[model samples]
Target: MVERKLFAGHAVRRLRRTLALTQAAMAEALDVSPSYLNLIERNQRPLTATLMLRLAETYDFDPRNLGASEPGGGSDAIRRRLADPMFADLEVDRAQVEEWLAGAPGGAEAFARAYDRMGQGGAASDGAPDPASAVRREIERWRNHFADLDAAAEALADELRQGSGDLYSAMAERLRVRHQMSVRILPVEVMPDLLKRIDLHARQVQLSESLEPASRSFALAERLAQEAQGEIEALVRGAGLDRLGERLYRRHLTGYFAAALMMPYARFLRACEATGHDVELLMRRFGATWEQVAHRLTTLQRVGARGLPFFMLRTDRAGQVSKRYAGASGSPLADAPGLCPLWGAFDAFERQGDVAVQLAELEDGSRWLTLARVVQPQGARAGGVRARFAVVLGLSASDAATLASARGLDLRGVAVPIGLGCRACTRPDCPQRSAAPGGRARLVNDRETGLSPFGFAGD
Candidate 1:
């Protein structure tokens, strides 16, 4: 068999720049001549296995990352973006898109961002970035894993476990002892609009009485995570976000810390593997909710002790995505403005509380194993209207064999064809398309209509 040489020049250059090392200095550290190192960085030479081992040993970085494509900047994403109606006249091809990504990744990212801005009603008039999008980008850039926070939360979890009580009791006790604060579950009438509030003057962490036991524990953990303000702030600062963006990101980081505390990395991973990535089983073991477990699954990218590289999406009934995290799966579904109605997430609402699984094939021929379920948000009024949501967790179908959720399934069977959205999708024969595809000429005939409402010129 011919050896597949790794041409990861951009990754090498990125690493070199991140280490703040001159080419010559990096070359010396890698035990390679500067000229050869330059060749390696320029794609003129393949990164040999021996050199990969040396790079890992000397730099203490993940070798796998050298070959991983940037999220939302891969050739598939670029090709999909170029398929927009605005670029239809350009007639960009797959090879050209791959060349662009390979030769100038930064340029490709800029193009993707510009296209995204156009899709989102063009760049801001005042040039202010959207805080939500900015924060999502930062999370994607980190593959939804913060190692330092994970470590800190794991250590805290160990300390909390030392107490001879439930996790929530232990956390409350720690708060009372360490921070001189007591937890009080106030009645709904007392706190009608607030789920949780920290009264500094009274030295109490007050939560609404309507909160479930799991939510109560999560609220306490979120408060406890604030104790790591220094570390979390350091990350927020490093994100280089605007004021609102920083605040939003800090909240997200606090939630991450809470999740990590609730489901410590090592123990959670073991439970997942043992249960075949069963969401309900993990929730039962960790005293968490389904949404919490699904979200935590996406953050198990902790290097050597990694879990499945799951990507999660949470959307309302109308398909408005509220949260998305594309771990290491490189799934573009997380980046789409809207989801295809044909995906399993929509079906989850119909099944309501039952797990819906699908083997979905994208336009780019990538297959994903998606597990979706409907979940009610944590806080709901006693007899008032409540909202429901669908949470979809997916990973590459190639990795589906290891999941208990995917067991006894026909991995080789036909898959449901899905796309990013009606506008961006190029699937011509989809019966569920609500709008005409971007780059296709609509086919009009006086006497004929096809499966899709909007017939278009085929590729």
Candidate 2:
């Protein structure tokens, strides 16, 4: 096992800022000397396991944020910026950059912010202003677990489910009794464009009749979230997001609440551990769709009762990503555009029922065991063609043995090399090159045939 260190100086500083506590005050709370805390904040000392536990217990810190190389949000973007040719003469290394992130994350962010402002006025910039794409990149670049929202959802689950006769029934009862809102199963014709809708004027929550009982219950939970929207908004406010971002996070939290209500955290973790993270069995047990099960697998970041840190990717037939979730910051799956078409998720479209098991190696030599399959929309009428989407669930190579899908596979053998995307890919001999790499590339024709469609002249 590779040793994962705890270089969480930035996290500690962030926590202190959030609590509005001075170094001495935080030291007193953590039962550490002020000088020790100072050393930790300066990246001069690594946090011990005991101190890490204390930090979590005292401040309700999410354990995932304390990783040695945890992305400090702007650090990854800064690293990408530094990779530009403008900084080629500078002696910058990963270790130095990480230390800069740990010791002075705010300064790094200020630099990025200033650089972005300078780029807005027609100045030369490393990257361009693609806010829509940048939003997606920023959102998926890091995995931050908000413990306040999670605890709130878990508490609601505890209240709704008593002895667990039927979780759906319990939720329905809670909705009826507490909110006085009735759930009606309306036909698809009545609610054509949307899956669920709330009529505040009539105090009725309407769901599509074609949905299964589990889906209906989840829709009702989403309505309940609307009724209790204030609570979600409060959590979003505490999350330290901007005004626009808070609105987006509020919607995300509501979906999170629905999922948490469907499958309680403790029960879900127990089921995952018992079944070796089997997707099919979990779907059957939880009455969730394949996509729902896969997405939930990424959100199991509870400090004490955590499951496998699996990242999820869902893409359409055109290789455009519809949804992506990372278990933690700096996920390899978040790399964009040049995702090799050879990924098994795309293959799942051709081979419908069969699961595509792959041992994929990234450009950085990190390997992952991925299981992918296609899932169609549930309850499609007999005469109509259903929309199919591919979902891929993967984890680091070390966790391959723990997954049932990885069994009977030669994981140690040569694995397929995949890139971030076609534009960012650097593989010189890819047979499936749809386009050339990002920067300028010299053409090498010489009136001679080559294996690849586009060949760089220098090579």
Candidate 3:
């Protein structure tokens, strides 16, 4: 069932041994602890771009064979193995599990093997989940999106898939290959030739003579957008998923295709199934940063096939919502549009790029299997301008039933309130209201003596 393009977990582990370096020695050389080195060897931690570079420089290792793509199962097997019952008495946190996964890959395996034999006593299942059922569940979860898009894009992809106008055309074709849509990227060289003049009648775009590189790139994208308009519109129509907030939902779906193309659905779905949903494996398999993988997981609800229903969100350093891909169920974060004070775990990134996993209950009664990590994005080329991005992955309350982490609390009635602000939020106890939802209105001051941000009638 494993794809050839995917990097093998055991293969990577074997690479570490082939080098003749012990875990402790490698850890010392890498300026990381022994445990961390072990995790990378076991494919628990993504041999990240940073770690991959370091391994090559220090150990004369060739990580390219490990590739930007990776095979997913080895690590998932490791995780399920770790949950073995022999340690049923021993309590373990997911973060601690990840840290060990990151640093002591091989040792983690040994420990898991020991734990498995001692506890599980032959608990492994022989059969894989029915691929068809997985697909059907995914379709139902996504509400039947694939059929509609396939029906709509069939003709367009056939026609435009062969056209070779620009990078956008090429990018569109790439999308077609993956999603059967004629979507392609606009290359840098010819981006300037694209004109902004939109022909509404023919849906053709004429390029202006003066655009620079960035503008041309955008223009080509604009034209591609125009060319694919009918198809895109047809896709939305085809999706049987009814949404609570239709406008916002549509805008989000439009973004979904963009994100999906950036991280193709089939490649990603297969990888997740193979990796057993190991976040690190997905990251490595896609050559995407941790944030990208986190964002991608949320979009799995697209085609209604092969996906675990989940809500995924992300925040930045100042707690701004840099990205949120919450399909039918939107992100839980509120208060700040770009910056959210609510998602505090992302703050851990400044410490040492560690992954923090938690089962959190929002003010509203929602439970989440939250995985957070810090990531620094290198510029387009090597050593380009780098910016750190915080990534968070979340699954709804019910889906977290198997994880024994959350405290013994019935999360069914729990409510995590989310709103624009005090004026809009209607939560009277908020002390940090900077502005009212509407005009200058004053309400009760729960923290102070006189008034809150939405104070009683001008205070």
Q: What is the C-alpha RMSD of each candidate to the true structure, in Å?
A: 3.7, 4.8, 20.6
Model 3 misplacement above 4 A: 1-230, 233-267, 273-276, 302-306, 330-342, 380-386, 401-459
Per TM-score, the best of the predicted structures is: 1
How far residue 272's Cα lies from its native spot in candidate 3, in Å, is 2.6
lDDT-best of 1 and 2: 1
Tens digit of per-residue lDDT, candidate 1, span 203-281: 9999998888889999999999977888899889877788998999999999999999999999999888888898888
Residue pairs with clashing backbones, model 1: none
Instruction: Give lDDT tens digits, candidate 2, residues 1-459.
Output: 233355668778888998999999999999999999998987778888889888899999865556422443544456555544344346466788877877677777566545444441235455544333333333443343445556666777787767456777777787788888887888878876567788888888877888887688778767666555666766555445555656666667788777776777888889998898999999889888777888888887665666777888888888878777765524556434436787777888888977788898876687888888997776566677788888988888777787788777777788998876665566778888776665637476778766677776332
Ranking by TM-score: 1, 2, 3
Query: Candidate 1, 408: how far from true, in Å?
Result: 2.6
TM-score of each: 0.88, 0.82, 0.39
Best by lDDT: 1
Model 1 CA deviation exceeding 4 Å by range? 1-8, 11-25, 43-98, 112-127
Higher-ranked by TM-score: 1 or 2: 1
Predictions in order: lDDT: 0.82, 0.70, 0.47
* Candidate 2 accuracy as lDDT: 0.70
